[model samples]
Target: MITGASSGIGAAAARLFAAQGAAVVLMARREERLRALAAELTASGARALAVPGDVASEADAAHAVKVAVTEFGGLDCAFNNAGYATAGTPLHETDAAVYERTMDVNVRGVWNCMRHQIPAMVSRGGGSIVNTSSVAGTRATGASAAYVAAKHAVIGLTRAAAAEYGERGVRVNALVVGSTRTEMMEQVLRTAPELEDRFAADAIQKRMAAPVEVARAAAWLCGDGSSFVTGAAVPVDGGATAT
Candidate 1:
């Protein structure tokens, strides 16, 4: 299952996971785009289903997982990638609603998904779960303070879940994502055009990642290839956090 699967890294992961022969359940607020992607994948002979809903809603999260188990038989993997960010605004100037929304989608979304997904995964004997964090998860990164805090919570949640469930055969990990050329990043760049150069330069590769780059890491983590990796904040950041 993948949240935020309508676009950006989530969409890329949905396509990649489906092509790799995984049954995918996509959850997102955009019903039209989600169903369109699911139809495209289904036409290509992949097992894909669209479950449109906000990840931040506990009931919606439960419903998505239930649909995944019903349609696909069981849940073996999940990419909890839905997130929200508001940059360029100083903390003092940032509205409380912005902070709440940021935390709701980024932190609480992952929490809600995991709360429901873990049981199905445990019943299956084992599973892999990948949560999306950010370079801001560890550093300020000039993003809004709310975004930074929320991402930090994501990493914490990933580690705690990994510890609690590893013995039960469920592995949890997070991606320390860098500046990527995703729709979200485009919005950030639009609001703070001057930060583009800085964003690129922050990475050792001197460029933002493509959505597929991050998606590949997620696929690797979710598959058996990374069987021994759990609770890791694996970097898909082109060395942005390496220094």
Candidate 2:
């Protein structure tokens, strides 16, 4: 199952997973987009189910998981990729609502999904979970303080959950993603055109990562190819964290 599967990294991951013969459950709040993608996958003779709902809501998260389990039989892997980014701003100048919204979706939403997904996976013996985190989780300048704080919490959650569930046969990991070319990043560039150069300059590769690049990393963590890897924050960041 993949959340935020309507676009960007989530959508790319869904397509790749489907192509590789995994029956995918796509979740996103955008019904039209989700349905369109699901149709495309179906046309290619791949199994796909689109569940439209906000990850921020506990009920929605639960429902999405239920749909996956019921429709696809059981979930072997989940990418809790739903998240949001508030406009970059200084801590003092940011609105409280913006901070709350960001945390609700980026942090608490993942927590909610895991609360349900872990049990579902446990019932089936074992599973892998990959949460979407960002370079902001480790660096200071990638996003606003609230976003950074929430991403840091995501990394913490990934580690704690990994340790707690590793013995129970669940593998939990995080992706320390770098700047990627997505609608969100494009919007940021439109609003603050200078950020493009700044982002490019920060990464050793001096360019934004393609969404498929991150999607490939996510697939690795979900598959038996990474059987022994867990509690890892694998960087798909083009050496941004190395510097």
Candidate 3:
């Protein structure tokens, strides 16, 4: 199952997993987009389900998992990719509403999913979870204070969950994603054209990642290939964190 599967990295991951023969359960606020993607997957003879809802609500998160389990039989892997990205601004100057919403979607949303997903995995004997974090989780420059703080909290949750659940057969990890060419970034650039150059300058590759690039990393973490990797904050950011 993947949250935020309506577009960008989540969409790419859904496609990739379905292509690899995994039935995908996609959740996002964009019902139309989610349905379209599911139809596309279904047309290709892959199993897909669309569950539209905000990840921040516990009820919504629980419903998403329930749908996945009911339709797909059991939850094997989940990519907790639903989140909000606020623009870069000073801590004091940022709007309180945006700050709170950022925490609600980015931090609390992941928490809600994990709270339910972990137990389901436990019941099934094991599963893998990959939470989409960002370079902001490790550094302070890419976004506002709230976004950075929420992502940092994500990494903390990943580590704590990994330690707590590893012996229980569930693995949890976070992806330290860099700048990716997603709708959210496009919106940021539309509002602040200067961000384009700022993002390009931060990475050694001098370019933002495609959604597929991040999706591939997430797929590996979710699959048995990375069976020994847990509590890891894998960087799918083109050397952004290295510099």
Q: Rate the local accuracy (lDDT) of all candidates.
A: 0.96, 0.93, 0.94
What residue runs in model 3 are displaced by over 4 Å at the alpha carbon?
none
Q: What 10-residue stretch in candidate 3 is worst by lDDT?
A: 187-196
Model 2 Cα lDDT, one tens digit per residue, 182-221: 8878877887887888888888999999999999999999
Tens-digit lDDT track of model 3 for 16-70: 9999999999999999999999999999999999999999999999999999889
Top model number, TM-score: 1
Residue pairs in clash, model 3:
none
Off by over 4 Å in 2: none
Clashing pairs in model 2, backbone N/Cα/C closer than 3 A: none
| Residues 57-134, model 1: lDDT tens digits | 999999999999988799999999999987769999999999999999999999999999999999999999999999
Rank by lDDT, highest first.
1, 3, 2
**Top lDDT hit:** 1
Once fitted onto the true fold, the runs of candidate 1 whose alpha carbons sit more than 4 angstroms away are none
**Residue 151, candidate 2: C-alpha displacement in angstroms:** 0.7
Name the 10 consecutive residues with the lowest summed lDDT in model 2: 81-90
lDDT of 3 at 176: 97
